[model samples]
Target: MIIKTVKSLSQALLLVALTLVLHSCSNPDEGSAIETVVYPSDVIPFMDQWKILLGDGTHTDEVEDYEAPNFFYVANDGEADWVVYKTPNAGVTSRTSSNTRTELGQIEHWTPETGGKLTGTLKVKHVSTSGDARAAASYSVVVGQIHSNEGNENEPLKIFYKKFPGHSKGSVFWNYEINTEGENAKRWDYSTAVWGHDMSVVGSSPKTYPEEPEDGIELGEEFSYEINVYNGIMYLTFMSAEHDTVKFTKNLLQSEFTSKAAIPKQILTLYVSLGRDGIERKNAYAGEIQYFKQGAYNQTNGKDPEDNMVWSTGSAIYDGDIAKQYANGSYTEVWFKEATVGPGTAPN
Candidate 1:
């Protein structure tokens, strides 16, 4: 009886030992557990239709299965997953642009006559706050644009969001880069205000910030824009719950600023530093092939502000270290919850 009892005890002990060993091997260390990264495509299904150029000089035409760490990814914005396009102030620049971008370029290109439509609903999360406050491009990011593919490769539309440090609200504006007929080097952009002061608004000095626009967008506020080019006419609609919905129309086939006399006071003040006083082509963007772009195209850079204060931002980059830039508020991050790209529909 004693031997049988001892044998039973031994079996029970052996079973318990085996169970402990199995559990230890099966359980993963909580500290070392890996997180599943969400790609931009996972959050935004339309990513398959466009290609992307990351801030790190990474380009992928096939973005359906592509993902880049620290540049483009999925982020949770309290309510839902959002597609984030983030870029440092300084990084491996693109071939045609001096600034860094984590933006998408549409695969489809269309002429103004054929027309195209693009829409986006997004929120500006952050912009660099360490640049020259007086510079026009300082503390600004390009959220959407229309880029010409041929000729001088000029940009016809650039939707911008700019905020000075210590301000509660930022300005939203759009710029039109003239397709200069002769020399591309003499081109300049004409800006129009959407929700606040136009890009022409600047500070009195390099360290000074202009008066905050009474009607402007606060950080993380939601806004939507529609770019509809129908029958050579470009129509824009901007909507936000807090502000009045605004609509604008311009003829892309005809030139509005054909002579220096037609230039607005804002343009004169904004372009004075850069000497970009050239006029637009008589037939503005006519017969040009254009494509749409969306994401965080960081306009701020580390360039010396004295060179061209309007374009130079002198933001801190920490030598292209993305982690350091994030820590120092030297990065641009934008989130998009919904967007669509397709052929332009006939206007009602």
Candidate 2:
């Protein structure tokens, strides 16, 4: 009888130890005394291939085994580990951008002819809960991007995820900004839906929200995407466990929207009010140096909605205080479990 009692006690002790381990992993920022702390490189091992920009405008190229307390770190949500990218709605941003981010920029650049590929498996943990609903950038974040290093420095692609307050599901969409033929003042982006509504679907007023999408992703749901630019053609693949796989293709060496009359009706609706109707260059993004970016690029900001209805979010920011913003739900957080960066692969 005594032997059996000891065996039962041993099993209980093992379970208790596992619980303690999980608690430590889920809350790494609680303290720095954790000996089992894991860095982002420990999970993905691709940190050496990229540099990082934190929400507070901290840049670093030495992420071999690094972790920043509030901006970048590791988290485990019971099942698996993830590299967390978090940023407040308002903070120090790049010179060209108003929003903030804690993101990784690929060190290597490639032309459309040379080509490259980037893949990621991730989930959205949080998005700003307060914003003017009529604004397109409200309650949203950009997860991946293909940024140009030449011309007007316009983005060729941006993958986004957005959710409205009080809604259980959000949308996953992508935008393609036209390579303007002349002055970039008229540049505009055309959005396409991947899992739910596109950027054009917004609330009618500051407080009102559109009807929730029936086919949408929830916060903390896992999804994957593959971007392959091969021989001047860009191929995209998106997959989720509960949703059907989706794919798209675009030519970077050729222009798809070079003519004024060729514009889609959606673009007319989204940008006609802003007077942005520029056409793309004939060669599109050909011969331009481009790089990849991945992480939580916070879209919401404290800019007044009356100024620019599209990009302005008019969300609460706690005066650019990151700690207060995090405590009050004015931030974005993304977690990635898997990712890769290398040369492009021919499609099977």
Best by lDDT: 2
TM-score, model 1 to reference: 0.89
Candidate 2: residue 6 lDDT (0-100): 100
lDDT of 2: 0.94
lDDT of 2 by residue, 1-348 (tens): 999999999999999999989998998888676587789999999999999999999999998899998999999989988999999999999978999999999999999899999999999999999999999999999999999998899998999999999999999999999999768988888998999999989999898999999999999999999999999999999999999999999898898898989888987877878888889999999999999999999999999988877899999999888889999999999999999999998987
Model 1 per-residue lDDT tens digits across residues 214-317: 99999999999999999999899999999999988889999988898988787777775578888888999999999999999999999998888688888888
Candidate 2, residue 169: how far the Cα is off, in Å: 0.4
> How much is the lDDT of residue 159 in candidate 1?
96
lDDT of 1: 0.89
The deviation in Å at residue 210 for candidate 2 is 0.9
